[model samples]
Target: MRMIAAVMYEQGLPAPYAESSPLKIEEVELEGPGEGEVLVEVKSAGLCHSDLSQVAGLRKRTVPVVMGHEGAGIVREVGRGVTEFRAGDHVVMTVGSGCGHCSFCVNSRPVLCDTVAASRGKGVLTNGARKLRRNGQALFHHSGVSSFAQYAVTVPGTLVKIDPSVPLEIASMFGCAVVTGAGSVFNAAQVRPGQSVAVFGLGGVGLNSVMAAKIAGASTIIGIDLNESKLPLAAELGCTHALSALDPTLVEKVRDLTHGGVDFAFEISGSKAAMTTAIAVTRKGGEVVCVGLGASADLYQYAHTALVSEEKVFRGSLMGSCVPRRDLPLYLRYYQEGRMAVDRLMSGTMGFDQLNANLDLLDRGEVLRQVLLPNG
Candidate 1:
């Protein structure tokens, strides 16, 4: 089948992100699933900071790679011998395409699986050798799904079944940010009732953190962001308090509000300074969970030993420590029962071509989440 996808290459560099063209897209033929693969007609794809980094050349790339990792789609065809799913099953890609036979996969920690270097990391076909291409030139596949296209040939284990009633367009965000943010709170931090917490950055991920923390029974959920534009939105999304990220006394403000300090602080801003603030606001024995991939080489130069001395648990979280098959339903149920409010998180619904333009809006801090509805 001929499918449209955004394809990248190693050609352009050292130019403005707006113009330093990284990749190009058009209609290309898509292949059928092999032994254990499934063909998904991607219903929606999500935009994440990680994708922006690679496109901007801030992160080294396997250039010529398809830029999407977060995708939600319907199973159009199941591979031979695959018993887990059939055609028309709504699902989200788990990002990690683990070889189920591997030790890490069996344990449900495929995110850190060793095969990233060989399979998804290499842009190869499922066999870890063939590159999906056009006109005899290699076309890179970014993550497991390369979802910035109409259809995807994916390994079965990487698919997480989701509730069909949940709109696939908005549901796609959970494939990454929602899972990352909410997972960090419930699974990673496990904040008990009345706990105090702060999420620095009110983007899609941070907002989820705020909402999750509120649902976790947190008494205080402070939202931090430089954009005054996001403050009102944060308040409506269950944030009990919010402060300008630029406040020089941001940490002190949190301390005064929480009366000592917050029990947990999440670094969702992806800014080095916000990261420092996230760490600074945590109380003794508190947990500071940093979720953003700000820069690969960037480190929290703060005293690591200081955390140990204070008995605080400082750590990083990935994909929200998610078990998607289990957690996706939980989030869906929360939304269904009014325990979580996602209706306001969507800034706009747009066709797939509006992706880059929506990202441009993200750069301007114009919206919380811009979703691409494939059929919109």
Candidate 2:
């Protein structure tokens, strides 16, 4: 099949992506699902910071890859041995797919599956196949999704069937932002009633963390960010206080607000400086959960002595330590019940023509949760 898709041939392009135009909109070839694979007609794909990192060369992947990881669509066809999903079923495609028999998958930690790690590192499907091509030249898949097109072929583990009633645009976020952010709170931090929470970086993921904190009954939730514009939405979502990450006394203020620091601090900005601040604002015996993906070589330095003496835990959360099959539906249920309010995160929708400009917008912190209507 032929489809229009955004293909990235290089990384670390100059800023003002609208001008540099790192992503080229072109017609590409898509192969049908083979054994254990599924074909989906993409309805909506979200522009996430992780995708931005790839564009900026902060994260490296195989070149000439279709650049999208979070999306929602309808199953158009199912390959052999796939009985869980059928044609026309609504689904959310996640990058956190795991081989179900791995130790990580069996323990409800598919995000850490060994097979997925190796495949994603090589930019191929779990079964080592590349289903995208342009003019007979194969293109690498992005996190096994490659959803920045009208259609995608992926394995069943990468997809989670969803209620058909949910809007695809809203459901798109569940694949990454919602699952990573909300899952960080519900699964990683495990905030209990009246626990104090602080979330660094109020983008889609941080905002979701704020909402999850509220749902988990956190008594005090402080939202931090460099962008003042994002703070208002954070407060609206569930933050009891919204503060600038640039404040000179930010740590002091958070500690005072939470009466000696928060129980859990989430770092979602993909900034090492933010990670340090997140750690500083966490109470003794508290946990600092890092959810953002920064430059691979960027090392985070912290007070090791304090970490030991205070018993503070520094943890890295990938895909919110989520088991997509188990958790996405539960989070969707939260959205359905009106407790998550993820709809507020939507900035707007875009098409292929607006792709590069929207990347600039996201890079400049000018937008939040922009969806690409590839089929439109």
> Number of the top candidate by lDDT?
2
Clashes of 2: 0
Whole-model alpha-carbon lDDT for candidate 1:
0.77
lDDT tens readout by residue for model 2, 169-286? 9999999999999999989989999999999989999899999999999999999999998888888899999999999999999999998999999999878889889888999999
lDDT tens per residue, model 1, 277-372:
877888988888988787667666788798789888877787787766778779878877877776667787766556666666676677777666
What is the lDDT, from 0 to 100, of the residue 225 in candidate 2? 91
> Alpha-carbon error at 123 in model 2, in Å?
1.4
Off by over 4 Å in 1: 10-21, 116-118, 125-131
Where does candidate 1 have its weakest 10-residue lDDT segment? 11-20
Query: Model 2 misses residue 202 by how many Å?
Result: 0.4
Q: List per-prediction Cα lDDT, in the order shown.
A: 0.77, 0.93
